[model samples]
Target: MTPEEAVTTRASRRSPRPRADAARNRDRIVAAARDVFVEHGTEAPLDEIAKRAGIGNATLYRHFADRRSLLRAVVLLIMCRVADHAERAAAETVDSLTALRRFVHDAVDERVGAVCGLLIDGGGQDSAEVAVQCRRVEATCETLMDRARHAGQIRADIGLRDLVISMSQLARPLPGIEYRDADAHRHLDLLLDGLRVPAPAACGAPGGAEERSVTYTEHAA
Candidate 1:
């Protein structure tokens, strides 16, 4: 089974293990919901998701029962993927900055910000599994930030929230500024470059990058 399938099963752990075909259908539905929700918010028609999954409306209803259950599954799906990316990035590299950038860029491809912003006020956010996934993301981000800060790669004043908020906003699509056409990675390069303090020359003073926010920790808090 795919990692996503594993997460989908875990999200519905209370339910009996579905038959192989039914499990495959559930996985496809949740994966489709993730993409459809990103493209058309949580209020998007159930037909759209069903069509995207190449399934009928009845099948979708059989698996999800209602929109709220589907929404919860989709949220858990994205959150679990986000946490997975963070963990994989850390495991694949010991370079803290590189790992952090990898995680952020992978998250951008997932279009987490758009889905999350739309569902921010939704009841799905209250899911116990959602909170667990969120905590995993936060913990990984914190570890990466601390390592990067100690190595003088990222700014000392920048907290974990700065990195979190940056990833979210960069992935969010704006009017006439869809993510696929924009230089989102380039913009991330700019923001990340801004976060670094320049190394000192052999006999000169170290220079600081232009900061965008000096109070994000408190402001976000």
Candidate 2:
């Protein structure tokens, strides 16, 4: 090829530099949206999210087509984060029970339940990306629960659905209570206790006497 033609070809084929600034803007928007949703549910205004991200409404809409689209993005981000946490907990903890318990604590601590409302109906986004991420999160939960059950750390009847529902309900904020209430953690502890297997009685005998057991009969907000 001629020199001029070769130069033209290289120029045409050269990939543009990575849009680092746009990527940073997208990250900021997602982070701001998550914070807003945690504080005010998914109905929080897009303008507020843009303001929080220090971006304009036009830019926000450019990144996300609409409110539902933005909600889907935030939910996807959260599911990915939770899935990573579950993997880390499973790999790092020595016992399956500890890993399972830590996942619940850390996930709730991350306010995953805050986004559960958005996921109530799949966030109204039918994209393949969302579906795949959801499956990964579900698989992690199943593995954790299976490990715990096999180790006799949790009741055999407990399943992923039960764990998720309980965590979602627990993560919800009470009407008149502050988000950082100590009682909330205590109540969560009670819920976790219910999922555990009962310990063997200190005394053993034929037709043995009743064993003292701690039954969590109620969960108070």
Candidate 3:
């Protein structure tokens, strides 16, 4: 090929690269926004997220039209991650109880509770999106519950709807309660215990019987 033609071809290839980079930067911004929102709640400033993502306000606005748009993106991203975690938990874990526990913990501690706070605090402005995300979360929970029930780890009579409602109800930090990982696990242990089927005599003692229950004396502000 002629030198001029070769140069033009290279320039054309390089031109789209910047657009790809811009797209990646937008994704990074959204991811950073999700983390910030989860940590600081939905009221977290967009400027802070842009700074954290190493992007400018204009760049962030260029990708996300408004605060609601950004929040929607964050919610969708979290839902997708939760779904992926669910699929992995279902496929990889040999122990259905373990998978169910992991799924519940991930949803409560890592995703659902966090997002639900944001949505509630946002005054349900994005109720439609929130509903969709909730359904996805419920589906994941159902999958785990089904596996646990089939394995006889969870009580066979427990319905997915009941399990989902229980998880949601338990996800919230009680009034005046200080939320902590250890505390969360303690509560989860109780819930798991309630779900568990009674072991046969040959199985001997049950697991987590000696674990201390978390005291939820305070409500989270």
Candidate 4:
């Protein structure tokens, strides 16, 4: 090879990645920030985040120059994860309604609803990248909804907004009530059941509330 090509190849090889430990610390900080935000809202102290991450304030500041920057990282991280889950649910699950159902359950368990509520109240999309990730997640959700709707699996009345509001409501922890994942899931199932289109009235019979109350799994069958 020519000397020029050799120098180019060496330069490419010399391009550096972050040190492994530094990268790991940043990830840990992002994760801890997410949990702390969920528990204490976006305005929680940066020191709390550093404490949760088991890192020094200096280290946290080294990774993120300020609270807004750190919050931005947390927001991007959550949205990215949500986007991945949505994409996976769409591609890997054969049955559209089942896929949607699985995605909703997984999202709820992820505390996505809670995180969103917190963000809405105090924080928001801090960067253009966050907005892009938000749209990506929404688009995947829309695709899932459209597929289920087209298949007559979910009700035509419900749309993405309805589903999101339902998720947000279910994700909230009401005052004076103990929070349990099981309870959240059970309520979510109810909402999902409400979103399913009831079977057509048999031979012009009335479509009653009882019919509408059937489990989504049974209706899917």
TM-score of every model versus the real structure: 0.78, 0.78, 0.68, 0.79
lDDT (10s digit) by residue, model 2, range 1-221 = 99999998898779665489989999999989988987877888899999999999999998999888888888888877888888887786467776776677777766778666887635635767777777887888898889989988789998888988888888887767776734444455566666767634422333222331221122121
Error of 4 at 120 (Å): 3.9
Pairwise TM-score winner, candidates 1 and 3: 1
lDDT of 1: 0.73
Runs in model 2 deviating more than 4 A are 1-18, 120-125, 181-184, 199-221
The parts of candidate 4 lying over 4 Å away from their true place are 1-16, 115-118, 121-126, 199-221
Cα deviation in Å at residue 160, candidate 1? 1.6
The collision pairs in model 3 are 175-218, 175-219, 176-218, 176-219, 177-218, 177-219
Residues 150-170, model 4: lDDT tens digits: 999988888898998888788
Across residues 1-221, which tens digit of lDDT does each residue of candidate 3 receive?
99999999999987765577898998999889877886677888989999999989999989988887787777777776777667777776457777776666666655555555655555244567656656776777687788778777879888876765666666656667677665665566666777778733322233445422211221111
Ranking by lDDT: 4, 2, 1, 3
Q: Report how far residue 8 has shifted in candidate 4, in Å.
A: 8.8
Query: How far is 74's C-alpha from truth in model 1 (Å)?
Result: 0.9
Q: What ranges in model 3 sit over 4 Å off? A: 1-20, 117-137, 169-177, 199-221
Error of 4 at 68 (Å): 1.2
